[model samples]
Target: MDSDRIAEIIIAEIRSTVPELEAQPITRADSMADLGVDSIERSEVILATLEAIGLKVPMVQLHGPRNIGELADLLHAKSKA
Candidate 1:
């Protein structure tokens, strides 16, 4: 999938999982914490995003993407693999 589509999915998941973040504008540079996602909510978002895209990423691999853009790139790469 393209990065834009991946970003859309991530944003959608964030909106669904984090109620307070629903009205905020999320961007590539924004970290999960910046969207008011605590560690636990971060995990929930990650898992939900993975499930939404039908991808199974290792937890270790998931640790590296600190921002939405990076996470989208990672998911795009994994989806291709």
Candidate 2:
């Protein structure tokens, strides 16, 4: 899947993991922390997203993304790898 699709899944997982964001508008540039998602909730979102995409890797490998878009791009690259 492309980055945009991965981003969609990420957004869905974020909404599912954080109900308060259900009504909030999320975008590629949005950061989970900026959206009031706690670290635990962020981890949950990431794990759920990884499951959705069927991509398994070390949690450390998923770090360094500055935003959802970057995360999507990273996941897309990793999935292809």
Candidate 3:
């Protein structure tokens, strides 16, 4: 999938996982913490996003993504792979 679509998916997952985030505009530069996503919420976001994209990225691999844009990029690369 394309990066923009991947981003949309990630954002949607975030909103679903953390309802408070639904009211705020998320940006590529915004870290999970910046958006009030705690550690547990972060994990939920990661798992949900991976599931949504139909990918099995290791949890360790997910550590590299600092924000939505980077996560989208990683998901895009993995989808292509």
Tens digits of lDDT, candidate 3, 1-81: 799898988888889999977889887778888888899988998898888888986788768787889988988888888
What are the candidates' C-alpha RMSDs?
1.1, 0.5, 1.1
lDDT of 1: 0.86
Cα deviation at 25, candidate 2, in Å, is: 0.6
How does residue 8 of candidate 3 score in lDDT? 88
- Give TM per candidate: 0.91, 0.97, 0.91
Clashes of 1: 0
Query: Between the candidate structures 2 and 3, which one is better when assessed by lDDT?
Result: 2
Return the top candidate by lDDT.
2
Q: What is the per-residue lDDT of model 2 for residues 3-72, given as tens digits with 9 covering 90 to 100?
A: 9999999999999998888999999999989999999998999999999999999989999998999999
Which TM-score value belongs to model 1? 0.91
Q: What is the lDDT of candidate 3?
A: 0.85
Ranking by lDDT: 2, 1, 3
**Model 3 spans > 4 angstroms off:** none
